[model samples]
Target: MALKTFVKISNISNLSDARYCAGMMVDVLGFNIDPNSSTHVAEDDFKEITEWVAGVKFAGEFHDSSIEQIKEAIKKYPVDYIEIADLDLVEKVGLLGKPLIFRLSITNEEDLSKIKSTLSYLDELTKLVLFHCDNENLFDQIDAQIGFYNGNLKLMKGYGITADVSLGNFPGLALEATEEDRPGFKDYGQIMDVLELIEED
Candidate 1:
């Protein structure tokens, strides 16, 4: 299936990776600004990289941070959007006037209700959602529930997406990425090879 790819780059700690991803034409770029996260990228570093990259959508990832904290980050290194993992914090930060990416963790069938509620709440707050789980089969089953909702909101599906989601599928395929780490892993790569592959594809 054709999908819109989102590359979550955590702690984009350097310019090399940023430039590569930008030039790669990735659909979405997620930056983990959560200070508590081990891969968290400092605002200054984030600003420096973002300044060089264009024609890409950016997301500020947060986990249970207060509005003020997000505001502080925005003041320094603003994003075109924000991604929140804690479902409960949805309403608190949704009104920031930027779009929201509500990341949800569903372990099994029992978590369906919470997922539904979150989706319902996002009706006017967002257009995208990220579903994650330890089991790939479970994630497929849970993702299937998207059809049950009667809204125009879009669900993000990554390689599992490109130079046809091999890179996008890495973390989820490895099952090592927690909700906190969804901004993506920072294992860097050679940019020219990726550009060539995309050209070939």
Candidate 2:
């Protein structure tokens, strides 16, 4: 069982990219639903492309959508996961029963405490959390210093992750990279322990 990674297709301007990524065995597909996002995908176009997206799971990557906005998107996309960077909206949306992919940023010791508390709830509410920031080893550092472990919270590396780096306990990586230089895909298995794909290579 290898680790699984997701490709964040911020903009699906090239429809073929989705098909190519899916064919490459990318585990999850992410689409930006925020209307103001530079890479925002139109709802109709998103729905169309999704029809061609087979096998792998897809998520509606929301920036700061309200509960109503999410409810609307779910009708059209009905994705498997809800990917969000807004910590304030977690419980509000998570309570709907859909698994979450939370993007959290922590810069110092104090933030780490908040992270511990957040993960405590996330361990029970969501599928995974992406540790984002300039700190490369933030995830491991926190665990070593605080010995914080939430039995149910799965961890992944975010921020500046690339394919070549070796991930420790963090089995997954979230990436915005596209083009040929992207990390190659990983075939489906049990969600993966320490290996996840970047959707495309």
Candidate 3:
């Protein structure tokens, strides 16, 4: 079987790892900017990354974000895709005419219903990255729901996707890790182990 690749961004500390893992097919990067905070990357960093990295696709992530904030981030950085967790914000930005990567946190059947309705408005999006919380069976249920879409949008899994999970079976699985708890954050050997697991079926 072929290997599945992904990128996860938690804090700015993971940027180095992301840069090292660049050139992979499915790359996930994040940018979180608070209106009054000066912690996250600045505009120059985004421009530098865009010029340095090539051939790798990025999914920009945001949390507790608003439409205006997201739009400003996208305008300054401009990645291959964008990840939004808020449904209402997604609906507001879906009308912007730019393709995005919507990240939905799956919890129950009702969330699926909401996704079905949201898809009707944001069908032009590049893909949907579903973040499953603690429930493995959720993937099976989502796979069935995805079938109803007739392959109109791609499905990528995230959140709680660890080395123990069978991700090889899911072609578009994206691994998400936090800077503090990430297995390979401090050790190269552990990172390779996680990568090996992802490549295995």
By lDDT, who's the top model here? 2
Q: How many clashes does each candidate structure show, in the order listed?
A: 4, 6, 0
What does candidate 2 score on TM?
0.73
Write candidate 2's Cα lDDT for 1-201 as tens digits.
222443333333335667765666666777787655766777787778788778778777888678788878777777788888887788888877678888777787777768667877777668778777777556567545334463666676565444354455555655442432333443323122223333223
Per-residue error for 77 in candidate 3, Å, reads 2.4
lDDT value for model 2: 0.64
What lDDT does the true structure give each of the candidates? Answer: 0.61, 0.64, 0.56
lDDT of 3: 0.56
TM-score of each candidate?
0.71, 0.73, 0.66
- Report the Cα lDDT for residue 190, model 3: 40
RMSD of each: 6.3, 6.1, 4.6
Ranking by TM-score: 2, 1, 3
lDDT of 1 by residue, 144-165 (tens): 5665666766665431322333
Q: Give one digit per residue, the lDDT tens place, for model 3 in 15-46.
A: 44455545333355555443334455566755
- Against the hidden true structure, what lDDT does model 1 obtain? 0.61
